[model samples]
Target: MTVTLQLEQLSIMPGQRIVLRDVSWQQFEAILTELGDHRASRLAYDNGMLEIRMPLPEHERSKVLLSDFVKNLLEALDIDFEPFGSSTFKRIDMAKGIEPDECFYIQNHAAMIGKRRLDLTIDPPPDLAIEVDLTSKTQLEVYRVLGVPELWRYESGRLRIDVLQSGRYVESPISPTFPDLLLVERFPGFVEMAATAGTRPALKAFRQWVKEQLQL
Candidate 1:
């Protein structure tokens, strides 16, 4: 006897994830359609492996704060960017897909402006992708296969910068996008500040800090 479970029947608790193996790309697409776009959970699919995760409150808070910091940095530097927050990016040819906590098109912002749909074969991947590693580890392989230039992973209250170099991610001390700014050194503190001092106040303080750095 065999039993089949509907995607809706499956319940993933906050800060937990469920992994399914041997899922075909077609099946992945169906699952995504079934899951729809109005949920809090995140999904990652690499070839035949699929992971569905439900984020905790802390995870959501961190994701928003970090995304805000990135926006602030770009604005302070007077760089134009298009933010695609948690939008599912997938390539059928590559057989890989991921929804980042926050993603931005910085260098290729102009190309992506006013785009409603993304065709990875013709369209470039996001220049920067941010992942908050609280419930599940980031599937770097999927990001690499998609050819993302820069990946920011926040784990254990610290941010790790990884740049795609010759088809593999190499850890770097400084962000390629903001080499002059010490984000790895400064961002974690501000994330913590948001928890205690409130989101608006922390963001205001961070903006001030950015101004100070720029003046120096």
Candidate 2:
């Protein structure tokens, strides 16, 4: 059985160190088994420390903005990646859980067919995971446990990336996962503009940027 206790006193601080406690990997797996697709997050205990995870709330604009940017970039470059569904990440099972803002798939969209529950063990990990952090927390640590290849965290309107290297996460400015793509410095600020531009304007801008990047 899993139990959760909230430590509201620990107000999340920006760039502050987060400590996870009282978690076990086995316990986390059990919780995942129970919740199935309904599960949002899970906790893992490694050595002595605990890790908690929950799903970040749904932000339609952010998802569309980011997804569209990636989709258009890939299409313009003739790279193949079709996004089928996006899910908000959540961690359950341990003493603490964190839910990232959004998660998505690049390939293997066929595996997701007719499925309501996500079996991480069966479902291949996403090609990319995106998190928009309004507050600081240990959400990224889930990537370590899940072995996701690439992670993108957006904060303060800037994007920071983490890619798995030699079985561990390393932050980098360049995206090894999609090396041909170029995201301009002003790209982060594009999200705010997306809100005002509506779908057509945003798509136009994204298409323009993609074409420019591809010299098409």
Candidate 3:
């Protein structure tokens, strides 16, 4: 006798992830459909590997706060952007798919505005993506295969910036998006401040800091 379990039957606790091996593209699509849009767990698929993760409350808090910082930075600079929070981006040809914690279209904002759906074959990947790596490590290879230009990963109270170069990611001390601002140094402090001083106050202070930087 043999028994098989459905995806729905599996319960993924917060801050935990389960990897499924030898998963095909068609099966991945079916799993996405079964999971639907209103779910909390995030998924990443690369070649024949699939990883599903459930974010803890701490993970979510950091994601939201840091995402807010991105928005505030873009706004202060008066730059146009489109925030696509945790949207699934995939390409069948590459056999890769990933859902970012938060993503933004800055340079490519004009092209993505008002778009209801994404087709990676024709449309360009997001200009920047944010990943809160408190729960499970982010799959950098998946993002690279999908051709995301920039990625920001936050872990252990520090932020790491990576820029795609020659089809690979290189750790950079400065962000290509905000060359004038020192986000790698400043963002972590603000995120920590948010944890103790509260979101709104921390954001308010961050906005002031950005304004001060502009004056310098």
Cα-based lDDT for every prediction: 0.90, 0.57, 0.91
Pairs with backbone N, CA or C atoms under 3 Å apart (clashes), candidate 1: none
User: In model 2, which regions exceed 4 Å deviation?
Assistant: 1-60, 82-100, 107-117, 134-137, 184-186
TM-score of predicted structure 1: 0.96
Q: Give all TM-scores, in the order shown.
A: 0.96, 0.62, 0.96
User: Which consecutive 10 residues in model 2 have the weakest lDDT in total?
Assistant: 88-97
Question: lDDT by residue for model 3 over 1-216, one digit each (tens)?
Answer: 857778879999998999998889999999999999887899999989999999999888889888899999999999999999999999999999999999999999999989999999988999999998834444788888888999999999889999999999899999999999899999989988888989999999999999999999
Order the candidate numbers by TM-score, best to worst: 3, 1, 2
Q: What's the best-to-worst order under lDDT?
A: 3, 1, 2
**How many clashes in candidate 2?**
22
Give the lDDT of residue 73 in candidate 2: 62
- Backbone clashes under 3 angstroms, per model: 0, 22, 0
Which should have the higher TM-score, number 2 or number 3?
Answer: 3
